[model samples]
Target: MTPTLILAIAGGVLIAAGIYLLLERSLMRILAGVMLAGNGVNLLFLVASGPAGLAPIVGEDPELIADPLPQAMVLTAIVISLATAALLLAMSYRSFQLEGHDEVADDVEDAIVRRRAEADLSSEAYVDTSTDPNDDSDSESGGRFDGGRVR
Candidate 1:
């Protein structure tokens, strides 16, 4: 009972710390947060799996057999988390090598996009003067139908 309570409390703390780190702008902190979160999740899963019992094998009593699914899932999650953490660490190191900092920089492309969008919104209305005024097809059908066909 005491161990279970401790595990739950520790897991909660880990999750909270991970989230706090994740909110930081530093990429390295984000990587650490991810690792912490993964470990917290694994601990939570272990706590949720009830008391440990006999190994799950052929001829094992159903009442004494421990659930294998959660353990398997946690193992897989650990591997995936490790891989992602390594990838993130590599990316953070590369960024530091190139940019000299782990802080996320604002996107210049987004500013350009915003300026373009504002220009489009404030631009003059479009006027098409290339169409011949004598063209009766567009006038009669309102540009929806062409020569009696639904085009």
Candidate 2:
């Protein structure tokens, strides 16, 4: 019968739906889930402040009006949530661009296996990075720079 009770039920329903959508494979559904959860939390804020009443007065014994605190709090929370959502969207777009898909990356071992296959196919042995093997003269025995001094 009360607004608080109504909001409680709504919040519960929203939370349940959000959880369901979050489990879905689609990216858009995930975003929708996040948004629904945010709204559900906002409803909780309003529900905590009791039903609407007369606005507070500027007096020693102030009238018990519907608290403005929750409304202001919800506004700030909404802005923060939007900013976070935008950042998540940008990251998702970048991921899609790089991988050509929106799905989560496969297991780490799968990538490692591909890397191992490429390594096995390589024709040359490991590179000799410290010195050039082509230098066959004893005159260049000093070798590469060792601690900034020619070794």
Predicted structure with the largest TM-score when compared to the true one = 1
Q: What TM-score, computed on C-alpha atoms, does each candidate reach?
A: 0.70, 0.61
Displacement of the residue 63 alpha carbon in candidate 2, Å: 3.4
Predicted candidate 2: what Cα RMSD to the true structure? 10.0
Evaluated with lDDT, which candidate comes out highest?
1
Worst 10 residues of 2 by lDDT: 142-151
TM accuracy, model 2: 0.61
Off by over 4 Å in 2: 1-3, 106-151
Please list the C-alpha lDDT of all candidates, in the order they appear.
0.82, 0.72
Q: Where in model 1 is the C-alpha error above 4 Å? A: 108-151
Residues 108-132, candidate 1, lDDT per residue (tens digit)? 8667556657666433323344678
- Candidate 2: lDDT of 43? 88
